[model samples]
Target chain A: MTAAFLRVAILPLVAGFASLALAADIPTAERRSGSEFMGPETRAMQDDDTTNPGMLWVLDGEAAWRRREGAADKSCADCHGYAQTSMNGVAARYPAFDAAKGRPVDLEERINMCRSEQQKATPLPFESQALLALTAYVGRQSRGQAIAVADDARTYPFIAAGREIFERRQGQLDLSCASCHDDNWGKKLAGAPVPQAHPTGYPTYRLEWQTLGSLQRRLRNCMIGMRAEPYAYGTAENVDLELYLMWRARGLAIETPAVRP
Target chain B: MVVLACSAAAAAPGEPALRSFAIVGDAIPDSLTGAPGDAARGRAIVFNRQVGLCLLCHSGPFPDEKFQGNLAPDLSGAGARSSIGQLRLRLVDASRLNPATIMPSYYRTEGLTRVAPAFVGKPILTAAQIEDVVAFLATLQE
Candidate 1:
């Protein structure tokens, strides 16, 4: 039996080596060549800009954070003081598994949770400009910190579910998330080079939209391309997808409201 | 109907040929449009790698692949959800459908200033390619 198992493993190893050899032989378009086609000036423009448009939302969020609202007469300042010092790196560990809720919660969800549980306020509507600004402000706290999602047993199922959703084929296009993002990244489609679907920076500013938007909104846009029915704004599918994205970008820095072409 | 007749009478047979065409301002059914597209041709546009490469921003039926764009929608069976006219608008120039769209016009005839000189007269996709793509989309019922 052991000998048979060894044989099976050996066969796969040989096949894997053959596949690697074939891959190496294939000619790949050089990175510089692709960049040149896009134009050196355009590329330089992208690198020159450091201030993310999302910063605009963050500024607004700062104001909202300080202003006293709700029936309880409390403000975000009441609990968290001087965000730069008190909330630094807080965004990096969000979308965390909340034991009380028995589910994963993103920064937006946490903000709303705090409003109701501690501030005695009504939760902000998802996708509302106010909520986006709040999220941007909170996310700014973890600008340089590496994302660190929990990988404990309790959270494993959620992560796995998220992964499944990412891989599942959907819509009229019969496409799975893995098809383009995982498979064809770095290649040009239409006129744009496909970037890895990393969530390091979110609530990003898009030149196409000329506005700041949340990661969920971005995902919704992708679904429309797939021609699949999108989940409601706060549905479990979206949350699960967020969980997967956060985990995928576990070590990348959070650049919320980043600029993209 | 009168406006259509007048426009058709006024249009020189070849003038419509050079003008950038896109289906706009009407909710025409797919059945009334031209015949369905050819999947083989549509696949070329979808997976050209250097051109159409729809896979860039979307995930689709093609599973034995890697790397796609993350910003756009997927296109597994787009035909079932949208009409041919809507598809035409998206293909001719998605900016018309959603001014925010990053997708470029495959049949642009005007506004060449925004594009490179080499691509000014050249469309991203030929009319035949668009027809084939639409035909293929019509087949994706499920």
Candidate 2:
């Protein structure tokens, strides 16, 4: 081939191959999580229940578990007996698809399902202390378990929508979740390290928030940060995104009540 | 919480509709507001959490701040690569350039929902602040 041919055709081909190699270098689900990017002190905070402020909510959840409410006058403990056994590994698999609801439901939604259906009680408002407490308590049960959201025939559609949201950019800023979590993770922008943003921990303790918050709250924070209008809590878009995140971080160990700075 | 940077009086009686400009290569003068641009004030707006909140997703030369994120590009030498026009276009509205960008439009008011009531019908920054940021960014050469 002529030298001109190489300059025009082969050079662009070489650049394309380099881009593919760079794409391959990004971490896979097995090796990536926000926890790895955090400092030792932050990790320790998530590890030790005593040091973790999120633990306070877990304790409240434990109390709420046994306290009877609603017309039926029953408690979570009444039906399940003990969270450690009955609720174990359950949080790791949510925002699971509910065949009846025809959509995915996160841990909070599922808890409300049990409350409204079984307890004959009113569902708690989103971001309320009682809901955060119960979510923290139930999420704690699945600690150390690997996340297991899936993309089966029944769930593939919502998972697909979630993936679209992850990749599709929006807002006045016109950026997507992938721009950070998928593209720029581990890079330092200001001074903080970006993580793969695995949703392993929900109802996490964010130092920025100065209190315990749900994944929905964090998602809203991100939307605001992006300069996009946030979806109302409990919207299909939000739940679908959560489902996609859970599926994305499928193998990562659950760290419910995680600490984030 | 939205920060009313200058004043409601600074706003023109009839704000012009947000014009979709091409990814910028030319500087836009203080068009919407006639106030003189000030760079020092721009830096304040960028760093303040109640205002620009730029530091949340961006990092710059400032060292006193904590918990600055890495989701977006650092601004240490932004002036070296981008012109004032480019920066202004980005700050005004980036979605038109790349519809999927996560950056907020500092100067857009239309097509947004769930905005704080106080910020309604008002851009996040005035034309003067946009020029001020453009001025400050222009000084950040390597």
Candidate 3:
């Protein structure tokens, strides 16, 4: 059994070890904005900001931006001031390394950190409506701005872990994420086109889900789809995965509050 | 419509349950009761993504079927390469051959998690369905 497990675990690495870092690495043309894979009707829905269901959350986010909360009596606007100006492009460069904490944090985790530290407020629960609204609102600020997350030596380990997770086979399905997103993207599944899964329009609305969702929520859904155990919210594994997604999607424009089927 | 989950059509308690087949070099225990291979039924199951859902990872020569995936080997010539016993073993449980294979066990149910209640202990495909799939795959010599 151990021998079988070792063969399953190590064989793929041994097989792909030589050129694994070369031709098939990131910055390939496989990158596609999520919008490219959707049906035209859905694409049309996303194109019109007023018609997109995601915009409703963006409106809620606009309200949350000004509404005061927390023990510190601070709203997001109190510190950042006008998402159009202050928060612009911030979403594009997130999953940044937190120097003081000595870890990686995606935008959602960063938002939670601010709530705890700066606002003296308890962190909003994961997948909460309020959190989704605020994230969507903040994410919308970077529309059309290219993703530019970091991937230097300091972040190399996290990036590597993220890549490893992408390639690792997990769950009862024994499927790796790359099996779908990398190998068979653009193909149809059940009738829906499987996009390259570029993380360009996260905190976006999904047709399967009538409400807006964070990237973590979507990742959780994928884990469940594959029957794999998912990382807890705010865990290093989740953040590293997010960082890898951001790096994989580097230079793609942000499309927060975007709608998808 | 492509029903992603194979949890539908539950067998009542005491039906032919999912039998465990130990890997014996590309051969699985075949013949359940009086069931035998049926190509027509297998072809329908293969094309119907909801039941066999083999098209999710495999592409083959089925007209009018779109979105044939490319994650695994194409099944267009699968019959030519593999014998019926080999095909049966793979369909029963590919994991027994390669533990990390992305292929789901269509007829095994021991180590799985999050399976819908309707599917617990019930294999994704029945013994007859497995035979049907094997028969259909065997016809794909070209």
Candidate 4:
């Protein structure tokens, strides 16, 4: 073959192989939930609703759903009506596109949006007991359901952005999320097993914190571990990262109100 | 704790100032504290969770320790594998050798992004402490 023919055909093929190597996501069959890494005690806590502390928040959320608040004098029950029916599989498709805001929003933001637009209530502060309760309640509805985040033209760029953040090394340690969750997963980091970081068990109850926390709280904790400045809650970057994690965790069964060490 | 005394000359209020040094090949040939670090004190730093945090991502020759990390290479034969200068360089900043290393630069204070307020302008370990870690790692010949 002529030099031009070799350059045209072989170089592109080589480049394609290189790109594939760089972006090698874990095979679908190999994806494991973070729960699998927990100790038997923690796993048992998650498996049983009676023992799970996260259930307390879920119960509180049930009450909040029915209680009337704000000037509109309407409860979440009035509009959404029976979270068990309306919110089923809802948490599975979060960090979804918002046409009005021209951006992606997570489950927490969606609840706030509904409160302001539908119930005419004040947006709940992030990480507050009330918000955590509501999130856990709604997330519990999607238990055992597979994560199926939106992956269309509108969300493609944001997912890509999240992927960039996941891979980019930051902080004094200069380690990326991929360095631990992707590369060193299933291995022990000082007695604790490093999990594959699927977002399947968010709005989870952590034994260390002794309370329920959102995925944003967990992400911020990880950023701190890397000695990096964590992004504030509800930031575009945070939502984008959630979008990417949920997309990566597609088909994994949701384990909301999960208890973890 | 013994290493803290060595930093008196370089201490700036609450902060420990980074010591200047030259890189020779892939190593820093000089002792960071001018005096050779105490190996005993170095061992204490390595095993001290609040100080070194080494066991967080490394498995060493300490049989007494129940929990050891599996992230980085085993530290059992570290001295047999590297020179004292090399160990010093690795502790100071392993990222200099491999940019993607999860090992924190224990003595570097510049070019870092978004450092927490409590850790601003501070390296993970002081210069004397880095020397102490290097000294201890150099003794792990087995």
Best by TM-score: 4
Highest DockQ model number: 4
User: Once superposed on the true structure, which residue ranges of model 4 sit more than 4 Å away at CA?
Assistant: A1-22, B1-17
TM-score of chain A for each candidate? 0.81, 0.89, 0.89, 0.91
Winner by TM-score between candidate 4 and candidate 2: 4
Off by over 4 Å in 3: A1-22, B1-51, B59-82, B95-101, B105-129, B135-142
The 10-residue segment of model 2 chain B with minimum total lDDT is: B1-10
Each prediction's RMSD to truth: 16.0, 8.3, 7.1, 6.6
Off by over 4 Å in 1: A1-51, B1-142
lDDT of 1 by residue, A166-242 (tens): 76655534455655665556666654676657776677676778887777888888876654566668777788888
Estimate every model's Cα lDDT from 0 to 1: 0.64, 0.76, 0.76, 0.83
**lDDT for each residue of candidate 3 in A1-261, tens digit (9 for 90 to 100):** 332344345535633323224335434555788898777998899989879899888889899889888899898888988889998999998888899889888878888888988788899888888888888898999999999887676776777678778777656565667767765676666556677777898897998898888888888888877767777788888888888888888778888878887
- Candidate 4 lDDT over A1-261, as tens digits, reads 322223234433532212322225677888999998888988998999999999999999999999898889898899888999999999999989999999999999998998898888999999998888889999999999999987777887787778768877777666678888877888889889999889998899989898899999999999988878999999998998999899889899999988889
Cα deviation of A7, candidate 4, in Å: 24
| Candidate rank order under DockQ | 4, 2, 3, 1
Candidate 2 lDDT over A125-183, as tens digits, reads 99999999999999999999989875577777777677667665556444567777766
Provide the fnat value for model 1, as a fraction from 0 to 1: 0.08
Q: Give fnat, all candidates.
A: 0.08, 0.43, 0.26, 0.64
TM-score of 2: 0.76
Residue B139, candidate 3: alpha-carbon lDDT:
94
